[model samples]
Target: MMDWRTKLLDPTPHARRDYASLATPVYRGSTVLFDDQKAVTDDWRQADNGYSYGLYGTPTALELAARIAGIEDARETFIVPGGQAAIALIYLSYCPAGSHALVPYSAYGPNKAMAEGLMRGLNVEVESYDPLIGAGISDLIRDNTTLIWCESPGSVTMEIQDVPAIVKAAHAREVSVALDNTYAAGVMFDAFAQGVDVSMQALTKFVGGHSDLLLGSVSARDDVAYAKLGPIYQQLGLAVSPDDCSLALRGLQTLAVRLDALEKATLQVARWLAEQSLVDTVLHPALNTCPGHEIWSRDFSGSTSVFSFIFSETVTAEQVVEFINALTIFKIGMSWGGVNSLAVVYPELERPGVDFGGRIVRLNIGLENPDDLVNDLRQSLGSI
Candidate 1:
């Protein structure tokens, strides 16, 4: 008879079993010892043999990377200190001096900043285009254009991009596409299957599921992009702490359960918000009223618990503050993908490039009962 536990623990032929009596073992160290002199010399080059040094990767990190790679159905995956670092590593690897990259206008705020600040400093040109540009992106691609970046159901405005159209446009121009998939995580969308060259996520969010660890992952289709990014990642000297990787691993075990609860509760809350008299618009891609609902429905399997809504003109700033302050369940905080519900008010529109205005509120639906959350919001709105 076969042991189920052994099979589960070592799913891959290359994976070695550790007898440690823990769900996931934490391995931490800076220097790794070799069994022999030739082994030491050969290990220095690493060259696909596992575990060269602690910083290169520990068993803890490799286990998490393997799990993520398995989920993405990709050849390889690498962990970074944070989500932004994962994005930066890709840029550093593929985009060289004088190269141009196109990014979605509504992409993550910090990602936009990276393209504007650091990418420019590296002599790379970063262009921000409308997420809905779709096939029109072909017009924007120049000879130097190296990459087209996309973020489905953009972070702030939550607009679902026509990914296939954009991918076709970019491919015609011989450009690679990178998507910041933090919002949908891997549960809702398959980036590789959607023709994305690179898929990245801030594991700190839904993957961590506890709002505790800071981690990020980048998955690539073939060895080309993965090989290109690997050295840069190692050279950058970025590594997730063993403890954080272990936490993310634990979070992955329950990701299916957490995301299911969040999806159900978030939709309920979004629908209620849509009907509220004090709401002018709800910017959830999962809702049919959103701008790119058709595209979202077409490309994505599910939506995350995060979304935004705009208050009606009659709702004043004072009232908004009153509503947020009066909430008993939704905590006012930034960052999401946790078991607890959170609420935050953002400038109605993004600044400098795009503006949705200042009347918008972002919500992260948690594991709380949908009825209780609705009641809290109703009471808070009544106070306003």
Candidate 2:
């Protein structure tokens, strides 16, 4: 009874919606139809109830969020566009206008920039404190101190922080603690157990296991934190593509094995670099040279592949460039956590507490063979 056009135009069509697969299905759409008008009164911010809006999350996004929450051992998680966006979400949610926040001096460069720029513009006072301050941070706390930002093992310089001490101090003043656990990837460090109010990570790094995608996640400790952060996250309009979420979910499947390999490979390279004539000191939390090595040893269960080394004073910037450029396997790049090895030189590190008087280069050990990577480094050093 129906023509071809009528058949095509009919909105009431059915397909088997339930099918078992090895991976979570990616559901992409902007509009989610409600079965009844009463559902309109339901909150779209809560992803647990049912389908809401695409911007809030698709099934793929929610799947990734659930996995990240499980990894973090937190109650709820939110996925954002990138790692930087996660930081912004926390800052916006907690650090209200005219409030104060304390950030580690050795935090990621962009986080520092955010504090100095947007946070400042919002009439918030962002104070930079030494990562090793520990309980001494209590001195900086004020009546308006709303949040404390911490980054362990200083992403670039590898200065481990006294997280428990910082947390105790912050909680004493009723301030919430937000930690950047990207380096640990929620495995090495237990953020929730350590009393962190909010745990955030760049899924682009170890979670994605490849440099191809950029995604970030924020996990809230309990219902109160979740309720507070959810609205702000929605207002920020942070949305990640379903494809990126699916890729991140896939990356989670092998995260354990990949991280183990990277850890073993990185420590081997770091030890070798420490003994090299061109190297002054290696900045790795696993090594004694790092500022808070003991703290890291006590708090963290494992180390990551990314670490930095400082060249001896005798090694000039030009020589450093020559050495880095001479490398065959390691590509010159910025971000890490990919299958391919990466190397970068930070000529002028503005970190105050720590000092790397000479050229500083950060290496991200990938899935490459340790022997081959060492050989490449030896050859590069010979060239310099």
Candidate 3:
């Protein structure tokens, strides 16, 4: 008989029966068991072959990846540590040293930071263009230009891009176009249909609707894009926790209902703010006042939680802070896409020829009663 300690250490321990559940099991593992020596491998493409190592992903992570790919109609999807990691992976994969890339000035602040910091340090020139540059992007492309990034209804400033035009221009130059589809939750916008080569999302927001997890997805539009991203993904070891994947999976189930309710509530709040005396503009893409509202209407199927609004020039920056602080229902926070409302003032927010002067307030509407939220905003505006 085997020694008691040896038995305890047995890797082949078995349970009586596996529970048949509708939910995907949280597969926490690092080392995968192989049937034979020849079967041993360390491949990231588990969906195509078989599980090789946990550093790529366990079954839980792959399920999330597959589902995201299915929803986005992507050729394949890579689950990474966070949205920023996804961005980094894509950049490193596409932009070799001496290569040039284009990113919108209105992209997520961190993306621009990476372009200015890391990509610059690596000798890759990432140029910033107007989000609405459209087909005019052709004028910016050069022989070394390898990538173009589009972030629709861009971060905080909320400029919806002319993705189709940008894609057409980039393809004309044989350059790849990538999109930050986080605001669309990977579903509201058809990235593949719009000719995007890769689409990425911060699943932490809408997909992990409770704000309880941090995850991101990079979906390749075809075999070519997938082949380009896969090796770099493996090299970076972009492993995510199965537990976080589980939370994202749960978030996906309620995503539709959450998005619908958020749209209605957010529109109500945004429209009300538009009619107010102190408000200069509402930056929600659904509103005609937004910079690329027509493009948003044409390209996007829907909008999700977050958007921005600017206070009139008469309002002081300090007054904006006071108003934000006075809000009871809308909590002061940075990230959005959760069960609770969030508000923050971007005092130093900059665009080419525009200065918000800290008067730009971005809001992430939650699943709260619109009436209560409006009342909260009404009371806070009065405080200012």
Cα shift from native, residue 67, model 1 (Å): 0.5
Which of candidates 1 and 2 is the stronger one according to lDDT?
A: 2
Cα lDDT, model 2, residue 380: 96
TM-score of 3: 0.99
Q: Write the per-residue lDDT of candidate 1 for residues 130-189, one digit (tens) a residue.
A: 888889999999999999999887886888999889989998988999888888876588
**What is the number of backbone collisions in each predicted candidate, taken in the order shown?**
6, 0, 2
Please give, for residues 318-378, the per-residue lDDT of candidate 3 as tens digits: 9999999999999999998899999999989888998788899999999999999999999
Off by over 4 Å in 3: none
In candidate 1, which residue ranges exceed 4 Å CA deviation? Answer: 1-22, 41-47, 351-356
> Residue-wise lDDT of candidate 2 within 130-175, one digit each (tens)?
9889999999999999999999978788788889899999999999
Top candidate on lDDT is 3
CA lDDT, every model vs. true structure = 0.85, 0.91, 0.94
Considering summed lDDT, which 10 consecutive residues are worst modelled in model 3? 10-19
Which whole-number lDDT from 0 to 100 does residue 159 have in model 3? 92
Alpha-carbon runs more than 4 Å astray in model 2: 1-3, 9-13, 353-358
RMSD for all candidates, in order, please: 6.7, 1.4, 0.8
Which ten contiguous residues of candidate 2 have the minimum total lDDT?
40-49
The total of clashing pairs for model 3 equals 2
